[model samples]
Structures are given as C-alpha cells and as structure tokens.
Target: MPYIPTRYFCLIAALVTLAIAVSARFATNDYFFFAGYVVLQYVVMATAWNILGGYTGYVNFGTAGFFAIGAYSAVVMHKLFEPPLVVSIAVGGVMSGLVGLGMGYLTLRLRGVFFAIATLALAIVLQTLITNWDFVGGSRGVYIIRPANGPFGHPYIQYLFLTMLVLSTIAVCIARAIEHSKLGYGLATIRDDELAAEAAGVPTLKLKLIATVLSGALMGMAGAPLPYYVTYLDPSSGFNLAFAVNSIAMPLIGGTSSWLGPVIGALLLATIQQIATVTISSALNLLIVGVIMVGFVVAAPNGIVGLFERGVRARRRPAKKEAA
Candidate 1:
C-alpha cells in the first residue's frame, strides 16, 4: 500500500463529517432539519456566485435571474410532465446555464460596473416577465403540493436536506476544480488585467461565458427545490435582492481566493442569521450581513481566510526563528 498525503486524509475526514451531519439531521426534529437545509442551500448558491464573482472579478447582479429561471423550470416540469424531483432540478440547471451563457456572451464585452449593471438589468427584466406569466403561477404565486410519501418518506425536510447537501457538495467540488485548473489561472489573469490576459492568449470571452454558465447552473440547482420547500413561489420572492447580496457577500467575507471562502462565509453568516432569527426579527438578518460586508471591506478586505492565513504565518515566524 502507498502512503496517502495528509490533505487526502483531511478530505476523507471532511466527507465523514458531512455524512455524520446528515445522519444526525435525520434523527432530529423538523425545525432543525429545515434550518440545516436553508444553510446548505445558501452554501450552494454562494459557492456558485463565487465562481464568477470571486474568480473572474465579475460582480454579477443577476443571480436572481438564474434562480427564477430554475424555480420556473422546476414548476413547469412538475406541472406538465410530473417528473421526479431530481429531473426537475436538472431541468432548472440546464435552462439557467443556457440563459447565463447567452447573457455572458452579450455582456462580457462590458467592463467594471457596466457588466454589473447589465446583469442587474437582466434580472429585473426576467422578474417582470415571470410576474406576467400565468402558466406556473403569475404574480399570485405557485403552490407545490408535495406527496405524502415518496422515496424519502413523508418527511419533506429530510428530502430537502439531502437534496441541498448534495447540491452544496457539487457546488464546492466545481469551485475547487476551477480554482486548481488552467481555467482558474485564466480567470485570475482576466480578473487582474483583461487586456494583459488577452495579450497573453487567454480567451477572455469564452472563459467568462463558461464561468457564467457554471455559476448559473449551480444557482439554479439551489433554487430548483425552493418552491417545494416554501410550498409557494412568487416573482418577488424568487427574484429577491437578498439572493444576490448573500451570494456576493459570502465570497467577499470568506476570502474569494479559495473555494473554501464562500463556504466558510455562507456557513458563518447563515448560522448567525438563524440564531438571530430566534431572538430578533428575521428582517434584520440582511442588515447584519450588510454591516458585516461594509466592515470587512474596510477592516479586512481579504476576508476571514486572509486573516486566518496571516495568523498562521505569524505563528510560524517564531518556529522558523527557533530553527534558524
């Protein structure tokens, strides 16, 4: 047998931890299960946003566009074909990816705030269109009447928790792959200097499009089951600013340089919000996130990961001096 690296061991340990957590949720009450599901969903969406916003330095304000597309996709599939839950999620992801690719192709030419504004405009337009569309429920909303018993039993929370868990895991894997691949380097170059990156033979437009498609697909997956979870879907709720803000804020606060950044930020922020909701108004959660985002931007622009790295280096300094 060959020796496994410490990193591989750590990875195995993390997977085990995740499995244990999922099992624990099954043994817990519905409220705990739902809370876990929401946090995991946030992790998925935030990680998806990080692909473009963090890696490519593109502030996409149209995450809600993909999210809405996904919810609608799921609703349409469930209403028309009566597909399985997994199929609905897949449909949402595919539809959102196609839309994202198109939007990327159109707006990748724009730079800085212009690109951001273009995405925001796209989101607004999509919201309006959905609001008028009645097939999947117009401005009123769509109600998803879940089955009493399915593959996962009568407990909706368990199924939602598992679904979100899988989605979040997939989101993390995709982010890690991009961060460690040539695409990641290209994105970093594009982020740092698009003109220089283009001069260096990086296909800026293609890379941006790929990133957008992937980001949108993952976001769509996160949103696909949302209608079932809430038992209702409305244009206003589906295309909310909180989705965009949380997706961006998590990466920024966690340290966008690595895949772990958005994951860490999402977990921390979601946990905080969940706890606060018990004692304070749920509406104040956004206020908390906004305050933290502003503070992080001014105090620790690199985020929690950056701070951790600095602390690690500081600890190692004394050991290096002793060895010398």
Candidate 2:
C-alpha cells in the first residue's frame, strides 16, 4: 500500500480511542469494560513481543517474567508508599527494559533454539525468585485495593480500559515508526542473518539489544495495570503461561511482518477468548487458543497478513502479464 505518516496514524488512533471511551460511557454492564481491558492488554503484549520475536527474529519465551516484574514492581510501590499509577507503570517499564538489555547482552550471541531456551530459563528463574520472596507475599500472593473513585467519576474499570487503549495505541505507533526507520532496517538485517548483518557492518548486536529493550518495556507497561485489574496477584497469576503463549500466538496468527498484524491478531483472539470464557468454561480458554493457533500454524504459517500479501502479489502478476 502507501506510506502513511506517523502523525496521521496517531491521529487515527486518538480518534478510535475517543470512540471507545464514549461507547463505554453508554454501556450498562461493567463486564464490557472488564473484557475490553483484557483484550487491549493483549494488544500491547503482542505488539511488544513482535518487536523482538517478529522484527528481530529472536523468540522470547520469558514474557511472563518481564510481565511479573511490572506487576510486582507495582505491588512494592503500593506497599511502601502508594504513588500514582503512572509512576508505577513507568518504573515497571524501566525495570523490565533493563532486564531485557541484560538478557540480550548475555544471550543474543546464541541463536535459534538456544536463545529461546535461555529466555524460558529466565522466566523460570524469575518465577522461582518471586515464589520465595516473602515480602511480596511469597507463594500466598497479595491483594491490591483499587481506588474507590476514578478520574472523572467513572468506574475504575473504565479508567483501566481507557489507559490500556491509549497504551496499545502508543505501542502500535511506536512499532510502525520503528518499521519505517533506519533502526528497523538494521534489525531486519539481523533477523535475516546476524552473521551476514555483522559482516555488512549493520551493528547487529546493538540493534538486537535495542529491540529487546523496547519490547520488554512495552510488555511491562502492559502488565503494570494487572494488579489493579485483578485486585489480587500471585506468582501463579503473574507468571501464567497464558501470557507467553498468547503473546507469541497473536502475532503469528495476525501476521508478524507488519505493525498492524499483532493488533489484528490480538483483537480477534482475545475477544474470542473472552466470549468463550463467558459462554463456555474459563478452563477451556487455553484449549481454544491452542486449537486456533495450531490451525493457523498448519494453514497460514506467515499469518493472516501474509495470506493477504500473497493474494495481492498474485493479482499483480496477472496485471503485469496483461500489460506486457
């Protein structure tokens, strides 16, 4: 298609966010806001994961580790001295980004399955640490009290939904900006072949580190609101395998090649999961996600975006032949 300016994209995102906020005001049931919040959270997580896993060609299985860092960071803040939610969110992002940088420095040298294994190990290590830390409630978990009154007198859940909506927009816009930037090109080279990229003087390691930091920060920000949303957080919930699974699955299902893919994938999958949770049993949510992901892996390895791109190219081939 055509190259659209980032400013124009931001404007569109703002308008869409406004529309969602307005719609929430009219909704009678609070469940819509609750469910919407979760969907938007996945949108942020999936987009974040795509920065490294999709764009940089490094699959990170430690999504839950970074996510829990964000959540527990908030917990610590609340217990000591409750700061504004924004502050906790910012701190969470920074902590996760730092960890990402360290992880990249240590393991980016290892490619393929080895790197993936390292990240999964990182998650296992974090979970073990959190499980034993008594101050954060150890294995028992902790409870958080949501502020009784939210901004503008709206329900706290609505506020969270709006926060997540804005965050998802920011994440998408940032991803799109990177996709069109020099850094993105450098990262793409690394994705294609790190050795070749290094030989080509592409600064492969630096680019990969940047991708990891940005990806981790976004994931942490996505998790920062979890404490408030759930009102209770334990190692089990914070380190849930679902976060890692969904983060990888959504981008793959939507099409990882472009910034829009994860958003599309997250919206479709998360919404479906939400409906299934309500209609069927919540226990079946992961099963449903697994089944859908398997189908996509079998039939559309490149994802929905790839399928559409393929069709476009196919049509263009016939047109060029006719012209000749």
Candidate 3:
C-alpha cells in the first residue's frame, strides 16, 4: 500500500469527527439539533460577511438587512407560489443579490466610515419598509408553517444544519478563491491603498461590487431557511443588530486577512455563547462576546490567525538559529 500523508489522515479524522457530531444530534432530541443548526447558520453568515468586510476592507453594517430580505423573499415565494424549499432559497438569493448590487452601486462611491454608515442606514430603511408592508405580515411578523417530514423528519434541525454546513463550506471555498485570484489581489490593493490600486489599473468599483453581491447572496442563502427554522420572522428578529455585530466581530477577531479567520471566530464565539446560554445567562453570552471583541481589538487587532502566524514564525526562528 502507498504511504498516506499526515495531512490526508488529519482531514479524514476531522470529517469523521464532524459526521459523528452531526449524527449524535439526531440520536438526541430536537432542541440540541436546533441549537447546532443555529450555530452553523451563524457560521455561514459570518463567512459571508467576511468576504466584503474582511477581504475587501469594507465594513458592511447592513448584513441583517440582506438577511431579512432573503427570509422575506422565501416567505413571499412560499405564500404566493408555494415553491419547494430549494426554489424558495434560490429566490431568496436572487432577491438579495439584486438588492446588494443596487446598494453596491449606490454606496461604493463612499469610503471607510462613510460606507459603513451608508450600509447601516440601508438596513434601518429596509427594516422600516418591512415594518409598514403588511402583506408579508409586516412588522407584526410572519409565521411559517413547518413542513412535515423533511428528508430527515422533524429532524428538520438536522436538515437545516446540513444546509448551513454546505453553505459555510461554499463560503470558505469562495473566500479562499478570492484570496488567491486576481480579484483577491485587487481587493488587497484596494484595502491597502485604493488610489494605488486605481493607478495600477485595478477596477476598484467593479471588484467592490462583486464582493458585495457575492457576500450578500451568501448571507441571503443563509437566511432562507431561517424563517422555517425559527418558525417566525419579524422585523425586530430578522433585522437584529446582533447579526451585524456577530458578522463583523467574528471576522475581525479571527483574522480578516485569511479565509479561515471568520470560520475560526464563529466556531469559538458560537460555542462559547451556546455553553454560556446553558450554564450561565443568555445576557451573559452577549456580554462575553462584547468583552472578547474589545479585548481582541485592543490587544490583537490582527486577530487570532495573525497571532498564530507570528508564533509559527517565532518557533521557526529558533530552528534557523540552531541550523546556523
């Protein structure tokens, strides 16, 4: 037999562990399954936000706005056309992508704090519109009738978790591609110095819009199953500030420069929150997030990934000295 590399062995071990973890949820009850689903959903959302906010250096405070739009799109499709779950999710992505494209065109003109403020305002405006619209339940909220016996049964939690798992995987792949491609280079240039990027013939505007649309579309997809997951959707819940904060915080704390950063951050923070929600108070979970965010910002602005990289370099230094 051929020699198996350590990397492949590790990969197989990781996948086996994940499979066991997912399977364990089904062996338990619905609550644990749903809790796992929520964490996976946040992972998807955080990864989506990282595309624009982390890679492109654009802090979009309106992620919840896109998320809500996607949820409502799913709801509207379910009501009007009664499409299957797959079609509804596709519609959600399309609607959110179009909105994001328009927003990118409108606000890509602004830079830095100005762009952030614009996106934040966009979220508020969308929430206000949803509040007044009445057709899709308005601000009063929309209740979705849970579908009976999905592929996995009332293990709908498992189904949603699988969906989120796929979405997060896709997000990571997309982010990695962007980080390696010409687009990633252009984005890095734009991040480091926009004027320099433009002088080098990079189409900053186009790249920025592409990042925003891709990011928004992924976020929208993440939110598509949310209505069914929670079985309720309201302006307050759909467009909550927690979405914006979590999306931004995960990437920033984990290391925005790399694709793994947001995923790492999401896993760490979400696990902490879940554990805290059980052992401590839910309010304390948010407090913990806040404290972690502040600590990261002040002490390790480059994030955990950056720290890890520095450590790796430091360790390599001693080896080099020994060799010398």
Candidate 4:
C-alpha cells in the first residue's frame, strides 16, 4: 500500500474516535463506558510504550514507573493547587519527561538485555520511593472526589472516555510521524545494531533520549486522568505490573514495526481482558495474557499484522505466478 499522510490519517482517526466516544454517552450500561475508558487508557499506554519499545527497539519495563510518576504528579498538584485535569496532565507529562531524560542519559548506553534489566530495576526503585513518601499518602493511599459532571451533560465516565480517545489519537499521530521520519531510520539502525549505528555517525544517545522522553511523557499523560477515574489510589494500584506487561504485550501482539500495531493490539487485548474478567475468575486474567503471549511468540512471532501481511504476500505470489 502507498503511504498515507500523517495529518489526514490522524485527523480522520481523531474524528472517528471522538465520535464513538460521544455516542457512548447513550450507552444504557454505564459499565460499558467504564470498560471503554479502561481500553482507551490502554490504547494510549500501549502507543506510548511502542515509541521506545517498538520504534527504538528499547524494551522499557518501567512502564509503571512513568505511569505512577504522572499519577502522583497529578495527585500532588491536585492537593497543592487544585488545578484542572488539563494542567495536571501537562505537569505530569513534563515531570515524567524530565525523569525519562535523566534515566536515558544514565542508561541508554546499555544495549539489549542489560538496558531492559535496568528499566525493570528503575520501576522497582520508583515503587519503593512512592511507598514511603507520606506526602502523597504513602502506602495508605489517597482518595479523590471526581469533579462535577462535564458541561456536555453526560456522566463523568463519558468525558473520561473522550479524554482518553483524544489522547490516543494524538499519541498515534505522533508515533506515525516518527515512524516515517529520518529519526525512524536512525532508530531502526540502533535497534538492528547499535555499534553499526554509531559507526555510521548516528547520534545514538540523542535519539534514544528523544525516544525515552516522548514515551515517558505520553505514558504520563495517559496516567494523568487516573485520579479522577479510580477515585482511590495507592502505590500498588498506580504501580501495578499489569501496565508494564500489557504495554509490552499490546505492541508485540499487534506488530511492533509500525505505529498502528499498538492501537490494534490494545483494543483487542483490552477487550478480551474486559470480557474474560467478567466471565472467568479475575485471577485468571494474567494467566490468560501469559498463555496468549506465549502462543503468539511461538506461532506468530511477528504478531497479527505480520501474519496478515504474510497471507497477503502468499496470495500475491500465486497471482504473480499465474500472470507469469
């Protein structure tokens, strides 16, 4: 397929996503809205994680670290100045982006497994810090009373859904732009062979830092609305392992080679989790993810998108043979 312009694609996606979110106000089951909110939140999270993991080939296992940073940033801000959600989101993004920059500068030189291990360690460290910081309620957790219903006349859940929808659109747009740019080529080089990338005059550190900051900022943005969504927050909830695992799994399952992959992966996986949680025991959710991930790794290493592409290529090969 020929390339589609980022502007056009994102605009259409934004409109469509927003339209669906708006229509969700009419949902008879409030549970549906709640579930959609969770899914859209994952959409943003997965897309953000993909920027570093998929594009830069840096597998950051600290998704929860950045997510909690944003969550607590908003919480701190809310307690200090009672800012609106938009301001909270902006502050969270800036705070987390700065943290990402620092972390990248310190660890981006490491490659592969080493780098991944460092990130997981980072997440553990952050969790420990949050668990003790009584200013944000420490391990006791904090309660937040959501704001009044939005001016749109729908319930707050619908507004939250729309907020996430907009965020997801923006994240996807940015990812697509980066994927098609010269920066993307540099990242690919690093992903394939960092030493070769450096030998070719690529500024490996600069590019990796850029990826880290962007990914962390987006992940932070995704978490900014959490306070109002959950109403009660604790270190455990904010730093849940599910965020990290799901973020990684979504992109991998969707096909990490492109921006669209995470979007598709998040929707499918989140939807499955939502259904499975209701039908089966909630304790089995992680087990289900593990099983599916292992199956995909063994059977479709490249993910659903890759499998679809392979099928198309197979069909084309037969048609080309007929033509010959």
Among these predictions, the greatest lDDT belongs to 2
Clashes counted in candidate 4 amount to 0
Q: Rank the candidates by lDDT, best first.
A: 2, 4, 1, 3
Off by over 4 Å in 1: 1-14, 318-324
In candidate 4, stretches whose alpha carbon ends up further than 4 angstroms from where it belongs are none
Q: In candidate 1, how many Å is residue 197 off?
A: 1.2
The Cα local distance difference test for each model comes to 0.87, 0.92, 0.84, 0.89
TM-score for all models, in order of appearance? 0.93, 0.98, 0.92, 0.97
Positional deviation of residue 57's Cα in model 1 after best superposition, in angstroms: 0.8
Across residues 228-285, which tens digit of lDDT does each residue of candidate 4 receive? 8998999999999999999999999998988878988899999999998889876776
How many residue pairs of model 2 clash at the backbone? 0
Query: What is the TM-score ranking, best to worst?
Result: 2, 4, 1, 3
Best by TM-score: 2
Scored against the true structure, residue 235 in model 2 reaches a CA lDDT of: 99
How many residue pairs clash in model 3? 0
What RMSD does each model have against the real structure? 2.8, 1.0, 3.6, 1.2
lDDT comparing candidate 1 with the true structure:
0.87
lDDT of 1 by residue, 1-324 (tens): 254444564476469658856576557467877788888988998899989999999999998889889988999998897788899899999999999998999998999899999999999999999999999899999999876555756476677777787788778877887777799999999999999999999999999999999999998989898888888889999998988888889889999988889999999999898888878878998999999999999988999999898888999999999999
User: In model 3, where is the ten-residue run with the lowest total lDDT?
Assistant: 1-10
Q: Write the per-residue lDDT of candidate 3 for residues 140-216, one digit (tens) a residue.
A: 99899876657656556666666767666666767777777789899888888889999999999999999999999
Which regions of candidate 3 are displaced past 4 Å? 1-26, 152-154
